[model samples]
Target: MADETPGFELPLLLFAGFRTLIDQLHAELARQGHPDVRPAYGFALQAIGRGGATASELGRLLGVSKQAAGKTVDRLVALGYAVRADDPADARRKVIRLTPHGVDALARSAAIFEELRAQWATALGPGRLRALEADLRAVAPLAGVRLDVPGWFGG
Candidate 1:
């Protein structure tokens, strides 16, 4: 059975689609022994960079509380994907940066993304895929959207 109520079906479908893709990649990561590969960690990795970021900036970017961001950061650091450094401008603050191992993992993920894009293009045809992408962009949710992901429709 499906929801027959007004304006409910599309959102459900969207969530299911997102969840499915994430689950597929996550399962693959798990198979490869990549621990702590949750979506939250992914979002945090995307927020950090070569130099890194403060917890408050990550919280603001991800629409989470500072506490939640700190937890995610701590997890990444523990897993060796990130490192915390004292803020040059403010001694009390700290910034997060991707480590060398983190860069390697990120590169692997980028390869996966490229492979997925090729498969999609072959299955859907370039023209139709572009149209589909434009349609999704038009309907995308603005609230709580994370922009740090490697690429959205642009990659």
Candidate 2:
């Protein structure tokens, strides 16, 4: 018999699965001393990366206005997740870098994600989970990972 799932259901199901993972991540984060971290912050932190970025650079990476990026920086600073420091190569520029706290949160998130994936694998059967991942990789865009999801989602 042909699959009867509606075309519109595919994207919605994908999004729901993504939401489930994120929701589970945030729940774990809250228990591990990062209750304030939001989904948007994850994308912003990834954009900032190891070397860090100026507000303008971050804004471009996140596909948002400089002011929006600055606001995110402000919040990160207030939450002790990041700091603004003078760029060594360019004293006039201040770059936003992740703090130890932020690094810990990211690390914890990574571990938690692995656990979540394991849970999914157990539920769906390991072979099915692997197949799902392979199928997703095949269909997903070839442009590499994107860091502008927060802005794209209008968050």
Candidate 3:
């Protein structure tokens, strides 16, 4: 039998799967007291990391303009997920650091992602799920799994 699936369906299906996981993650996050955590915030938080980053540094890491990174930082501060602190190394610069609430949200997000993966393992069978992951890793550039997706998508 000839295969009829279009070439474009592969990327679409992969994106759809990603969307499903993110939607489910956010729903759980809302129930766990982070109702305002958006997907972009997650990426920005990751880029900020434990050591934190200045707006310019974050912009470079996230592949966005400094202005865009500043706007995101503003939102994060407003949402209580992050705070702008005077950089210890340089008095003229400010760094964006995740708050306790942000740390808690990131921890919860990690746990939730594991739970979701387990659910997928149950649905697809453990071996199949592992194989799927392996297959993806084989084809997908490992180095390309980055935190700049929001900017890459022009968000």
Q: Estimate each model's TM-score.
A: 0.77, 0.95, 0.96
Q: What TM-score quantifies how close candidate 2 is to the native fold?
A: 0.95
lDDT of each: 0.74, 0.92, 0.94
Q: In model 2, which regions exceed 4 Å deviation?
A: 141-143
1-155: candidate 1 lDDT, tens digit per residue: 99677798878987797776677666766666565677667767777766688988887766677887788888889999999988889999888888887776666666666666667789899899789778887777455366544223223
Clash list (residue pairs), candidate 2: none
Top candidate on lDDT is 3
Model 1 TM-score relative to the real fold? 0.77
> What C-alpha lDDT, on a 0 to 100 scale, does residue 57 get in candidate 1?
87
Candidate 1 residue 20 Cα shift, in angstroms, is: 1.8
Tens-place lDDT digits, model 2, residues 26-83 = 9999999999999989888878888899999999898889999999999999999999
Find the candidate with the highest TM-score and give its number: 3
Off by over 4 Å in 3: none
Model 2 lDDT-worst window of ten: 141-150
